[model samples]
Target: MGALDIFCYTLWILGSVTAFPFGDTLNRQAVLKTNIQTTAQFPNNTWLENIAVRANGQLLVTTIVPDAAVYQVDPTQSHEPLLVAKFPSALACFGIVELGLDEFIVTTNNWTLSTAASPPGSNSAWKIDMTTFSESSGQGAVITKVADISTATYLNGMTVLDKTAGTVLMGDATLGVIFYLDTYSGEYEVVLDDVLMKITVPGPVKLGINGVRLLGDELYFTNNNQGLFVKVPIEKDGTAKGPYEIVARFDTILDDFAFDTTGNSYVTTDPDNTVDFVTQKGSVTTVLGNKNSTLVAGATSAAFGRTFEDEGILYIPTNGGLAGPVNGTFIEGGKVMAFDTSVVA
Candidate 1:
């Protein structure tokens, strides 16, 4: 068989042998009494990967499968989503982060889902300027290619390390390293590499150090293979200042996460169809969805609403288990889900 066929065969073998555990083994319940609601829904097979909230309270969602594009969704109104931009050459758009007031940075990849493979020199980054963008006016934002990071494989999640310096850190899942990129000059380098960031599982499905974020001087990341959410002290330039510390552990894999004002994190468990709440002190609980709940099924990434009216609500974008469906059978169209955090237990 050919290379693509061989790769597909390998994935099929892994899928048959691997046992991805679901459910709350710790008996964790809803930490917050969340009023979950579907804010926006995409077509079936749309793999919504990551999310970022615009200053005006709209959410920018990145789609990896079916189409490699960025969509703008206004949570206040359940209307149709507005197309922000599309990457025709790439097969998927993976991560997004707000760099400036209304400007954002995004990562795109040329990987195929069926074959589970990506061609070399197919990874790149872009900038989307939405300062003067308006949904009704039909005015499109300025799209710019910032850097071509072909050296790093599978750039999944991103977080701004130093906004003033225009520096951002992107997690390279396959390479088990973080690429430090300067958005202005398009210069990039491998900033952080450690065993903690390496993948423990053998297959291509489970990734290592998939989600990354920076708060103050601490760097936080999640490894899907190891099922670990960890944090470490880091410099402004993306260098680790201290050793990595384990924040929490999970049986299922983690995709991406968003931090609230109070330092709590709402993380997405892809196959488990759940959004986990991780407190600053490392308290882990299932605050929304579960192995059976469709509210946030196939949840991939999350972000909190920017406006004061919805600041307490955590906005989650789900793939509806596009890659790994709930119970290995249930799947739905990718959609944006909102969990009101103000309604506490």
Candidate 2:
């Protein structure tokens, strides 16, 4: 079959699956009532790819299109995005995580969504230190290039595996592998390579293993093309402590997710424009948004608020239906949404 035919066939198969995990009777079509508020909005074509929250509750948002830039958004105040810093020679910025006190690490690449391949030696990591930046003083932040990931393609989600050891795990969706980077030494190596990380079907969207996170002794991730949320016990050294387990599976594309204190995972469905709440026991519920809803539309990545005032808030950044338009026609400017998860029913 041709590529378009295969893509259409994949969608049909995905849409046909309706059984819930472990055969629970809960309706998959149920959408929970959520309290959502738009915190910030950018230009119509802006693609907000990833998000990270500073200790003081400001948001660090990244974009991949138009420019590989990072902006600092204060959710509590005017919500105007302050230009933090832009990366040089990078078309997009992907995963970002806090490395240390007010310091962060971000992944940069020259890859475009229209093309399947990125230029060799264009994948790299950089550090953003927000230590001296005071909003009152109008001081700027510092940006430094950490290391180049010449060996991989399409580095997506990231999480700090060991902070003191300066080791961060990054998922390469194109390569179907995970790389462990040592921030202190600027060295990186492939630490995990499994067949489950690869895309199951050959089509236009070939993304696999989109999101990666570490909670306690287990590492959780999402396989976008396969539509699976998986987890595996891991050591601090980035090695698996046991076999990987499939937490849940769905009929839609999966993106980045955030965990709550009670071990519930709020996973984003990029094309479906919804957030699935996956409990520790593996049951899934569509807790926020839907395929036709503009609320958290094109939600790409999410992070819970850091400060106590907004700790129960799930902050999501969207590409504004750039990936897949809601109801196949609705598209808007990229935005940041604050969902009050504590008030969700």
Candidate 3:
């Protein structure tokens, strides 16, 4: 071959190797062994909604019970949450995360029993002291408000970015935007908007952004109705680059997600109903399913916690199945279930 031809061939090979997609090749699997023995049920008064872990390993959970209470469940015994605070009745707690050693924040929706398409409450977020369980209302804890956006509605999912001065990033499902809220100052700004594409399914497919997780420089989110998981690139300038790509697709409603230190992302699906764990490479395996009729109802959200003394376990909450007799309840008596990830294959 001529010298110029050989050089061109080398450049082609190099470019091909550099541009090869590496994320799709990884195999993700979540082998869920049903552990009926380890199940921890929450009290009837408290309907567990979402859960978060503190730096010290204590679990902070939000509930739908009266008094806007945030419960702290011992890592060892998650069934019984130690009641931390009983704030005002107006606070309709949705998701929660710890801000510091003795403080935390919780998100609220409108105080309504119906799941109608309505805007989330404009009530400012509240900051609570973990030590005294004292809450400061009115913009102290609100990172962002619906008023901040001319037409914003619901704030569904939230997670704390510890590296960013403890700022919390929240998903507003109603308007398809992600807001970055300053926990310390209550100032908020839109970091991501129109990032998720609406699922064009006929007859009300649950197609809005639900759960979000940050893995390295990439942000992953769930499209609940379409059962799709997507990954977006995070630029150095604190913005995300998209043409957002779908990583995995399942047959259920994807709700919430949590990642272990090993980069395995666990997802909870409702309606069609199942729980799955996906690896960083976009492969999925079912951890919990209705195959054996084991999970009495559809799984809503899940969080990982320490079991016994130091082993890791998963805590899942169920929204009773549609065909079952106990339908239409947010979380009934048989709502909470636990699995020991250390023992599951």
Top candidate (TM-score):
2
For residues 1-345, write the lDDT of model 2, one tens digit per residue: 345543432332122222223422223555766588889999988889999988678999999876899988888856468888798779999899987878999999997867745666789999998998767644668889899999988898999888788889999998899999999899999988887799878766688999998876677899988888887777777888778777777778899998876667789989889888877667678888888988878899988876657777889999999888888899998999999888654
How far residue 271's Cα lies from its native spot in candidate 3, in Å, is 3.2
Candidate 3: worst 10 consecutive residues by lDDT? Answer: 12-21
Please identify model 3 stretches exceeding 4 Å from their true place. 1-32, 36-39, 43-46, 65-68, 87-91, 116-123, 132-151, 162-164, 195-199, 236-238, 291-296, 306-308, 320-331
Clashing pairs in 2: none
Off by over 4 Å in 1: 1-27, 30-34, 202-205
lDDT of 3: 0.57
Q: After aligning candidate 1 to the native by TM-score, how far in Å is the CA of 93 from where it should be?
A: 0.3
- The TM-score of candidate 2 is 0.90
Off by over 4 Å in 2: 1-27, 32-34, 136-139
Better of 1 and 2 by lDDT: 2
- Tens-place lDDT per residue, model 1, 1-345, is 345543532332122211122222333576545487889988888888899987667899999888789999989874579989999989999999988878999999887778655566888999999987878964669999999997987898899877788999999987888999999999999989988789766765556889998766777898888888888778878898887777777877888887765566778998788888876566678888778777788888988776657767888898888777777788899999888877643
What does candidate 3's lDDT look like per residue over 8-83, in tens digits? Answer: 3233212211111334532435454646333445644444566765544566666554435566655556335556
Q: Model 3, 246: alpha-carbon shift in Å? A: 1.2
lDDT, candidate 1, equals 0.81
lDDT of each: 0.81, 0.82, 0.57
TM-score of each: 0.89, 0.90, 0.74
Say which prediction, candidate 1 or candidate 3, comes out ahead on lDDT: 1
